[model samples]
Target: MQNEPLAYRMRPQTIDEIAGQQHVIGKDTALYKMIMNGHVPSMLLYGDPGVGKTSLAFAIAGTTKLPFIALNATKAGKKDVEDVVADARISGKVILFLDEIHRFNKLQQDTLLPHVENGSIILIGATTENPFHDVNPAIRSRCGEIKQLKRLTTEDVDVLLKRALEDPDKGLGKTPIKITDDQRLKIADASNGDARKALTLLESTVFASFEENGVTVVENGTLDSLIDRVGVFGDKKGSHFYNLLSALQKSVRGSDTDAALYYLAHLLENGDLVAVSRRLLVMSYEDIGLANPAAGPQVLAAIQSAERLGLPEARIPLANAVVLMCLSEKSNSAYVALDKAISSIHSGKTGEIPSHLKDTHYSGAKELGHGGYVYPHDHKIGTFGGWVNQTYLPDNLIGTRFYDPIDAGEEKRLSAIYNKLEKFKKEK
Candidate 1:
């Protein structure tokens, strides 16, 4: 317990201890009352990371004193569901906290249907993405209600920080630390409504500022050093460089060519081709993804040309890339999908690679259950096709699709291909 991070150690034991999300976990809320009564219902919890999804699930189980089994959809397979069912058989009921529940494909979700229907395995699904957009309809329909945990308020984060500083058992109360109230608030503000981030910063400040005499003074300079981990555009916190980059990206993403060009010129005038180029490349994929597949290479080419041309001349190719990004059909579906996949991984959802997808080039690989590799080239569907319905993901994440192309420009064609492949896979 002492070795665990402060955030983990400070997780709310019951919903009452939860910092924010009053609308759901407040004492007067029906959900709070239900959990207090030991009625743990199957439900979906969605929100950005660090907003207490897992904490809420754990708090519910704690309040109810029920068997809590936490698993991640990207890692857990049917066997995991069976384990929960088996636990329910003995305990009469079990709370299965399925993190990244949106990653559960059809087969895995289907396996839970009977158990969920019988009230043996009460499902508590948690995800950062919109459940309706990613979760299968069957699971969504069965869940009582999809609850969204909003980001923690600054006040809420500050409250947690203070609590952590004072709580001897689960926090840093044992350490002799000193910090101004303003500095504390600054930490909260820097965290941007993330309690975990706030705690991490507080912990960092304590350790970095700790003196040889067993005392710590958390100063603004120490905080600045730790908080500069983000904002690649600037060395100082909240500098104009960061503002320009943010404005530039937002302009391009919003399809404001004029604004995008304005910011690009401002950045170019500031004389940092590398930063501007890096941002343009990101905008190509992050803002104008598959909708304009060529935008990536086009922007890359522009960057290379600009690099060779240098300075005032570099602005020419750079401007071209910027305008192209702004006017192009915009779609963030690609990165959104990837972000969801990344969120699942961050939530400890990574699983072993499926046997069929494992490398078979090594000696004695077949004896290790790494056989049955399917060559997609062998099953060509149609023209412009070297594809087959194969399980390329881990067995648990078999049907998870991490690249959801949108209906825009070339991505429309990609979406069509994706839909066709999905249909074919389902048929098979």
Candidate 2:
């Protein structure tokens, strides 16, 4: 008999045989019922590789007893999809499983839409990429999406390892090597919630044990050797994302260029690059405003460039912008000014615009004495001092200054304005 790959050989023959994905395949779930009742919606299963998406697709096909047609979208195109749909229609019942569905271009994906809608073939798309960004909207809209959660917890991996070790027909039950709790836990840690990887690592380690112990027992050294060779990245979830991001943002806010660069590296390594770019853009406004007013536009420009170029190349511009934002002189005057203005308005402390400042756009406004305003341009001083009339600020903050400019490049001009406003207020 020809040998199948370990992944295929260990495939779950039934829903019960499937490990994890309890949210979708658990008892009485929509997916479970659909598989059991032959009403499975055309679905797009998205997750990192080795997380049971493809296995689930196969198990569902087997349970429904449908003629399963598999396609790797990387190699297939519009003509290939149309041929598959045409042949499947003749077969009466077919479930088309498209692996790496994101690889299919718009034209290729469009060919499958009519067949999916008409029920000629129930499409089951499996993708490793995030569906929101990778898949075309039209193709994605047609399929019900289920995210396959990454294998991260020890408990989930433990169950999977036990199953692989126990199943004689499918797994390495025939192997003489025995696994201890520590070995299993370490393997689980190494796999990082990826079951396929765990199994592969397990198989290799067991083979190593056989080589060393002569088909009788497995030792810790064998497991350790396997673990040493395997790499594991900790799960980036919950507070890790927010806490680390807060530090990065604060470093930039504090204008510590070195500290900001370190935090940027941490964010790039542990967090989403896109998320990092977004937070940096906000910090440009909240921390670097007016003092280096150009920081905000630079960050925005980097964001646009990053989207167009994607990672690696995108990383260069994003990193450059991040460093520039950190080194830029800090000022929150604009943010502070807006906050006070908003607070005053919220407290019902705002007044009508001075009649001189009111709109003169209409003839009726002019008739109502709206255009009887002194033109600042028409004055020799070209400044607004006596032009002020009715108060818009509250009693407690009538002349309360908010925007105090730093001695940074462009902000010196604003500092001059602040000085002029101060002198004018004193004269009044």
Query: Using Cα atoms with residue i matched to residue i, what is each candidate's TM-score against the true structure?
Result: 0.58, 0.61
For model 1, residues 128-246, the per-residue Cα lDDT tens digits are 76777778889988898789888788899999999999999999988888888999998888886777878888887888885757678877887899988732222322234666799
Instruction: Please give the CA lDDT of all the candidate structures.
Output: 0.85, 0.75
The Cα RMSD of model 1 versus the native structure comes to: 17.9
The digit string of per-residue lDDT tens for model 2 on 204-292 reads 77767754454546688877877877643323543335656788889877767788787777667664777887888899889888888
Top lDDT model: 1
Clashing pairs in 1: none
Best prediction by TM-score: 2
